[model samples]
Target: MSLRAILLITLQQEPGTGYDILQRFKAGLAHVWQASHQQLYRELDRMRGDGLLTCETVPQAERPDRKVYHLTAAGGEALDTWLAEPLAAGPVREPLFAKFFAWERWPADARRRELGDLHEQLTQRLATYAAIEEEWFAAPERLTPAQRAPWHTLRLGQRLTQTWREWIEEVLEEGE
Candidate 1:
């Protein structure tokens, strides 16, 4: 999905300051999509120029003025259209897999260490998903069904991570 479409959906769901959108977007998909704050802010400007979103500047006594963005009617329509469209089918790309493809030169211990590191990272991600699960349960209706959306994405990540962990464990057990 284009970042523009994501931004539009977010604004349509709940209008907010650039900072608010930035944080929320990160929490939503940063683990997988990984957009920087700069990328989002810059896109916000571009969307504004294209009439997809509107900004209201609010003066603040304690800090710099804030620009909160809301999706225009056009933006909402655009998001709906994008949501209805079929998602593109693309090949999966994993840098680690690419590296490991030519990893015969790396020592066995080094490969094992890499696998251990990946396992640790996956454990941390599983913990993160547990935290999100708690929050979704606490506020049942604040967002879409966690099982249908973000949780689905998290599940994909967890499944892939666990699959790799299993493969690594098999390699170790077989004395590869």
Candidate 2:
């Protein structure tokens, strides 16, 4: 999905400043979609020009004015139409998987180091997912209808991370 669609989805949850949207992406959407601050700001401008979003300038003390965004009716329609379309499975583009595919070419020590690094990264990621899950469970009432969809995606991320960690452990054991 285009970043525009993702931003629309976010705004549908609530009107927010660019920073707020960025935080939302960092907090949850990073699992599936990622955008740098510059990319998001540029897209916000484009989406505004496309008439899919409306922006409000709010004055701030000791800071520049803040621009808050809200999805327009057109944006809602665009999002709904996109959601109705059937989605095709995209090609896997994992760099780590690519490295594994060429493991035979790497020196033995390099392979071990790479595997160790991946294992460490995956372990840290799983811990983060666990924390998020715990927070959600602790405040079930805070989850809104809009959050339910992303919550399911978060569960998928947790499961996938767990599976990846298991596979990494098996590979490490095999290398022993």
Candidate 3:
């Protein structure tokens, strides 16, 4: 999906400043869609120009004005239409799989080292996701109705990470 659609969905959840949206990505959506601050800011500007969003500057004391964005009617309709469309399967583009395909060319020691490194990285990521999950469950009362979909996505991320970790462990045990 385009970043525009993501941004619009975010705004549909609630109006927010650019920074607020960035925080939302870091807090939860990073597990699914990764975007840099530059990309988000650029897309926000483009969305504004496209009349998909309306921005209002909120004055601040001792700081620059904050431009809060809201989804326009057109934006909401666009998001709804996009949501209703059938999804096509995107091509797989996993770097780890690509690296594994080239593993035979590496020395045996290098192959072991690569697998060890992969295991470590996956472990760390799973830890991070676990912490986010814990935080979510810690405050069930604070979660808005809008969070249900992202919560489901978070569960998928957790499951995918767990599956990858288990597969890596199996490979390591098999001396592959």
Find the 10 residues in a row with the least total lDDT in model 1: 138-147
Which sections of candidate 2 miss by over 4 Å?
Answer: 139-148
Better of 1 and 3 by TM-score: 3
Q: For residues 100-149, write the lDDT of model 2, one tens digit per residue.
A: 77778877788788878988898898787777767664465687876577
Report the Cα RMSD per candidate.
Answer: 3.0, 2.4, 2.6
TM-score between candidate 2 and the true structure: 0.87
TM-score of 1: 0.83
As a whole number from 0 to 100, the lDDT of residue 24 in candidate 2 is 84
Candidate ordering by TM-score (highest first)? 2, 3, 1
- State the lDDT at 6 in candidate 3: 83
| TM-score of candidate 3 to 2 decimals | 0.86
Instruction: Score each candidate by Cα lDDT.
Output: 0.77, 0.84, 0.85
Clashing pairs in 1: none
Q: TM-scores across all candidates?
A: 0.83, 0.87, 0.86
Q: Weakest 10 consecutive residues, lDDT, candidate 2? A: 132-141
Clashes of each: 0, 0, 0
